[model samples]
Target: MEKRKEILNELEELSPILFKIKAEGTDKNIVVPNGYFDSVENQFLDRRMQVENEIDIDIPTDYFDNIESAVFAKIKEREIEEESKTPKRKIINISRGRERVRLSFLPLLTKIAIAATLFFFFIKGTDYFKSNQSIEEIDYLASISKTEALNYIAANTHEFETEQLVGIEFTEEIKNVEEITSEELNSYLYENINELNEEDFSEIF
Candidate 1:
């Protein structure tokens, strides 16, 4: 008890303000607004509800529901487009009659056949009609029209090749014609002009 009293006296002499505060005693004097704690939860809820109510956005009807199907449909369409672009070529025979045709690259023989068909369809239509041939009356321009029974190919050329048809252009014919030099033509003519007379010319014509 004597040691305690000596310690207190030393503290008081060292700091007189601290000594007076200790002597007087003290209580917590912090002031808070009334109902501040009680209203905290209510204020937070009100702010959250206001934020929720204020958020207004528009979306199309059924948009979310149909999104998956719409995406699939677009994917399928793109797949079909990719698949349709193929390198394989399609060749259509005029005899078979296809919807789509790219005939520019047909073989010479195939082109000749197609040319013959076109010739029959276009040229002979007039001649056969002139000869009183009807659709029912004539057959495929008739294999039996000539006396000898259907000898398919004749040696006669100007009469045979579709290009040799009078004054008409065979636009589809792919035959190559070699250029005749003037010297060659002159030499041929000098040699054969006598032999190529009126009858020969007439026959050729």
Candidate 2:
């Protein structure tokens, strides 16, 4: 308690004005020195005037009014530019794809057509060569024997005419006669007696 009293005494000694104000009643009017508030009011007015004079920044009247419209116009122009670029990019891509497809397929189709044409010509040429071959050449190539051919001709002889069988140099004259023995001549005479003429009988006699 004594230490608390000593601290209070020290605070009272340090702030006598505070103690005096506390002793004065709240109802008492506080007094000011002569022209004290007037000096303070003059200082404030001077400071305000100096600040207003130092600040010389000015703005055009229409700047704020058109700022929103200018910003929106810029945004709209950017959108239109992007819209225009989109179709151009798509067109370029599609054209490139079509060109690639044509380049890839054209050569393949051409090669297939050429191959088909070559095959057709090869087959036709083979058939033409076979058709132009001679019958003798065909028979030789087929390994047919002469006897087989003669037998086939003989079997179909009715189809051939007498003129076609005989040569252009054939003659009706006899070239020679072979001598016959008496026994053979006698047998022939006896066997052909009915076919004999008077001239043949005269010669035989």
Candidate 3:
């Protein structure tokens, strides 16, 4: 394009001694060719030098590509450096006091449980012994004579083959017999034959 070439030509004309000066200097101190264009070139170079001298740094290539990204990277680097200088936070176990107290009481609690269990069993055994002591023991046929006692036991013997009534023993203490008449025996057997039970046969003789 003609417009692009014109701009390039103008840029070339604007700078003739770009690498000639590395230090601060005015355009009047530099040489220029004799022409109307030389005056404009001198003014342009003066302005260029003034701007360059005011700058504190040489800008990086990437700064022109993405200015916001470059600034954000600089801010993040500063923050990382500040964090590295700060001390780390320490974590403390909150339950340590309760744990120590629990450990101290554990043995005492176990011993208490064991003692309570033993005391409950001992109380139950004593109650069982007291109850058994109150029960009356049955005496061996103390209300009947030797002949009558033998006959009564024989008659009341169980009829089941697995069950049998063995012998009886009289104690050292003597007992008085409550005698029944012959008429009473006859009336009892005649009237109660159908209603007779094994318990009744035990007293029939």
The candidate that achieves the highest TM-score relative to the unseen native structure? 1
Model 2 — which ten-residue stretch has the worst lDDT? 168-177
Q: What's the distance in Å from true for residue 141, model 2?
A: 99
Model 3: CA > 4 A from native = 1-37, 64-90, 93-205
As for lDDT, the candidate ahead, 1 or 3, is 1
- Per-candidate TM-scores read 0.19, 0.18, 0.16
Rate residue 110 of model 1 by lDDT: 33
Report backbone clashes per prediction: 0, 0, 0
Q: lDDT for every model? A: 0.41, 0.39, 0.37
Candidate 1 lDDT over residue span 1-205, tens digit each: 5797787798799999988886777544657789899999999999999987786445456766764454334434533553466233333332222322123222222333333534444545434334542333113223233211111212222234332221122222222111222343335435656645564444222
RMSD of each: 29.8, 53.3, 47.5
- Summing lDDT over every window of 10 consecutive residues in candidate 1, give the lowest-scoring window: 146-155
Stretches of candidate 1 exceeding 4 Å from the true structure: 1-30, 56-205
TM-score of 2: 0.18
Best by lDDT: 1
What number of backbone clashes does candidate 2 have, counting pairs of residues 3 or more apart or in separate chains?
0
Clashes of 3: 0
Q: What is candidate 2's lDDT per residue for 46-141, written digit by digit as tens?
A: 999999778645644675576445433443453455345533211111123223211122222222223232333344533433343333311321
Error of 2 at 132 (Å): 95
